[model samples]
Target: MSEPREQRAARFKAALMKSGARSDTSLYEHLVRLLSRVREEQPQDPVDVLEEMSRELKRGALQQDRGALRDVPATTPGQWLAEQQRALFSHARDEDEDDLVETPLPNLAEVAFFFQQAGVGLGGEEMQKVSLALRQLSDARPLRSCRFWGKVLGTEANYLVAECREAEPPGGAGGEGPGEGGDEDAAKMIVPPSTYKAPPVVPAEERGTGTNSSAYFVCREPGLPWTRLPDVVPAHITAARRIRKLFTGRLDAPVTSYPPFPGAEAEYLRAQIARISSGTQVSPLGFYHLQEEDEEEDEDEEQGTTRGRVEENPDFEPLPVTAMSKSLSAWVHHVPHILTQGRCVWVNPAEKPAAEPDEDEEEEEEPDEPEREEGPALFTPLSEDAEMDRLPPWSSRLSSALVPRFAVAYVRSNLWPGAHAYARGRKFQNVYIGWGVKSDAAFSPALPPDPQREFPGGPEVTEEADPTPQEERALRAAAEDKDETEDETEEDEDTE
Candidate 1:
């Protein structure tokens, strides 16, 4: 089976020459270095040494190629969507600056300035893009009112939210184009479908400050056309509370989990925005004095002229900025507390019986349970100074805690982390730039390994130590005894 040494040497020389098509100088040098290293160390297995060298070369090659690992340019609005955004802010043909019609879009520039003052806002670059993108959005759609809601950080990309009130409802005619359609049409399909189904009926929401008052639009970057989110229902809110998920920044991404979310990422974002706004939206003490709206309108109705309908507070005043921040009581929840059923309207603030029914009249009782729904009234005192924890749900302090005059009253909401507001004299600004998650009392997130306490554990085998040989023998003996008993029973049956 032995071949001549000259013949083997000739085969090796031929293989080396053809390694890179034609004579390869790099391969020859690499082989020479490898052979020299192996010859000096005297490796027991040259084959294993060759494999190790190949792996090392691969790793080194990957590390050396800096071009492959270069950073991607961040998404920006400067280059894209420029024309439409400018057209909305200015008339194309007109030269005069006076004709520059103002847009109802919130002055995010000023908002950004306020954020800078409070030390909680986006950077200059992101703010500029966000501002530009917002203009484009306002131009693209018909909005009753539009404002920068907040930025929600996702895993792959962050979402810029635009809180808007539609001048017309989504189901109305002429809702086409990007950002035009408020519901189903706004979604971007990552994957195409052969079949489709109609969107679910969205519950009609009444105006006034509440959870569902405004619709939310999201985009990965400012220049991108906004995708309008679906109106979140109570069920979505209830289920969202049961789990925590990091967004993947795609419109049609499915939320595959327990207590099953009814729709895609859009619906999940809608639910989260609703939940976040309900809890964190706040104002300085006495910033809003709610008066009973349309108090005398329903005179002809069954419930006759009521005592000014105990709804919006008629009169409220403040002492001063320094005095307000001295204690936490000065601050109040400007937004209404969301009921467990997800209604944000301040109905039944406390459990007091409505007017006593007549002797002939029976009590209008709910069939489900006896007690009426109850919650704290709107603008209820936040919490007292004493009994306050190291980290209270809300903490109030002046820009200069003791000094007055130039001090701005800053109140930070620890419950939602990034929610903050500062009141200087009458001027106040509220900004929330966060992951759009509600901070719980617990530190870690609700995840698998240690599942949430609310949900029951799934079926799983309990881990146990391995049995000894003697224990195994005993188990086998028990099995044999059972088999013998069964055989004896069968034999007795045969005899019978």
Candidate 2:
């Protein structure tokens, strides 16, 4: 039999006290107090939570060491020296690990902005260089450009060394040429044009002049590495239309903007957005500062009268990105997927009713039953209700969750490292609201690309004039005399 209600309540109270909760009076009062305490304890936000977890895991790993290794005896001097070296190496590695306790995680909005900056040059020269490097690596050929390795590989140590032979003359006997089965050989050796076609160059004067500039091709064909649409159908137009609706006029706006709703609708949406963004069921409603009533209004109305009192706006104060709107929250969760998902579809409920036999047809069918086949059934059809039930809910079909998994995989395989590196190098300011460190540097807008400008972040190489033979000889004689004088001065100083 189940325990009595009073006994259960007492047990629960005792459990709470055991778990570091304080009780002042009755169990009911204790529960209310415990709930209030839990509500007050809002730990770090999602970004900081990830950072804290990472730090704790690292610290735990570092704390765990083999005590037995310390007690092990070395049989020879060389072995002892080797053991000492290993210990030193381990100590150095531990020292190199970062202490994340003092460092705070970056703001989500700043991270979004950094990603936006990285995606800007996807169809530019940077992408072309990356594509070229990919082709070389796939073909097991030596990379021709050191700059490519630096930009794409992050460091020279990451570059793979390959031994490739030089191609023979085109006209030589048994040599490949355009007319002599060279086309087939070329096709085998080179990357497909559809996979790596460079974006067309637009002249500065002609750019943003017409609709032609607006058109962009995400993929050459509608299949894997692009869209999951059938070969006969065009996916680009459908994908573009859905994506336009998904984002609308929201991407360019800051998260602080209030939802265009009054009263309860705004409050409900805000609460939902907050819950989804933080991945938590319960959160504080946030603090509100009540405004004082006007003296004239107070005088007009009797004391304790609410007649002629103005109602305060529920959403007058601005909220952070985490508590903004559902659209923004969904975007944060699925940014990488959103960028690559070529097409999306929303399933509409069927309007037409299931077909029923007519009166005459029913009468005719009753006249005689057809002979049943003896073999096993090839296929079975589901009932109308069952089929309908199997379909996903309308909400799940929204762009947020409808993005194909393949698109995300493609992005991770192709674009992740470069984008990550780019974002990692830049500074993330305003980490916690308008708080944290203040920088002295003035912000300057990035300039549009110009061919005449020097290569970015690279030193200019200038050719120096060569010295004549007479000048070279004179310089050598001066260097020798200077060395001799320095030696004599050193000898004099020693004597003194």
Candidate 3:
């Protein structure tokens, strides 16, 4: 038989006490109100209301371990590793007692920015380079650019070893030209310098008087930089737009500038542009001198240069003049598909929805239903909603939970690492966050803070509220009255 509401409440109160909730009357009254509401609305079954309350409290406690649900919970061993890897390689630090430094892995937009910076160019070239590089790198190493491995790869290592490769010669030979009917013929090609020989310079006066410099293309250093979008392009536009967009027209506005981008976004965009611009008749003078550090362990090692073995020769592929030219043709003809392939990864401008396919065609290519990797463990196909649900209600309640309009300076400070971890987990699921450290040890406690005076910004003080002057005065007067009354009572008792 079910107990009376009062009896059930009494049991819940005991459970709460056992679980470490404060036993103050105010808190008790608050819990009682909730219990009354739950009883009035939801009927109890095999599990009594008190039992339900206990279960909920337990869930709440577990949620705290789940980083208050702000953290992306590990779904699989691989994902857990990825989280660990990110945390290990993150640029953020923990300043609070909680010690959870949220460090998200670099994202595609950021990846694109790197590509753009590499002068691989954005659009078609970027797509091709990113995909080809990743595929090649994966073949070389199981998960070269996986989020966990991203930091290890570094900008130079990723570019040299994991980022996309240029079209190569047939026979997998570095300098040898392609043979007829070779893969090199189909391989995507970039512009060659010979195509754009500078015309014999005419007299300075003969130059057109109406100097109309096209903002579309600017001269750059040879290599990817020449052909690809500038790292400064996105920055320029972003800065320009930000300056215009966030303009309150107030001269004394706080933080008068759009925050500087870490150049990741620009790199990703450049890569994207390169990918989209692939196969186009690019000018070789359009060089993007991709700066790569010598990642070679010995003199024989060239960062991106692969070592051949019996199964896979360490030789480089060569491209033919004709094959390189054909890349331009393919780029022009397949422009639409190439442009839209994976531009969704861009951040400066968020991706627009893909146009609806024709009814008959839609039947031919049904949108692939999301498939969760089947396993004994709980593995859910990720979604914005699911990710949001993983966080505490307050954290996820903001319009832009990922990027809020304004955050507490403390939350913002704490969020840097958390954001890093969050973005990494969401974007790159395969990489470990702290790959070097054991998963359990990734978030281990750090050195204790030194003793210091209590202040507005102390870590110990979470939420601070100021009391009214009247309230402060009342407390002071009450203390004084109590002391005086105690003295008078003591004197009367002594006389008796």
* Among all candidates shown, the one with the greatest lDDT: 1
Q: Sort by lDDT, best first.
A: 1, 3, 2
Candidate lDDT (C-alpha), each: 0.66, 0.27, 0.29
lDDT of 3 by residue, 141-234 (tens): 3221222111111221122212222222122211111122346754566745443333221111111110100001111110111122222222
Count steric clashes of candidate 3.
83
Instruction: Please write out the lDDT profile of model 2 over residues 445-464, one tens digit for every residue.
Output: 34445556544563456556
TM-score of decoy 1:
0.56
Once superposed on the true structure, which residue ranges of model 1 sit more than 4 Å away at CA? 1-102, 168-209, 295-320, 345-370, 384-391, 400-404, 443-496
TM-scores, all candidates, are 0.56, 0.13, 0.14
Q: Which residues of candidate 3, in runs, are more than 4 Å off?
A: 1-81, 84-163, 166-496
| Candidate 2 wrong stretches, greater than 4 Å | 1-123, 126-357, 362-496
Residue 309 lDDT in candidate 3 = 15
Per-residue lDDT of 170 in model 3: 20
CA error at residue 64 for candidate 2, angstroms? 79
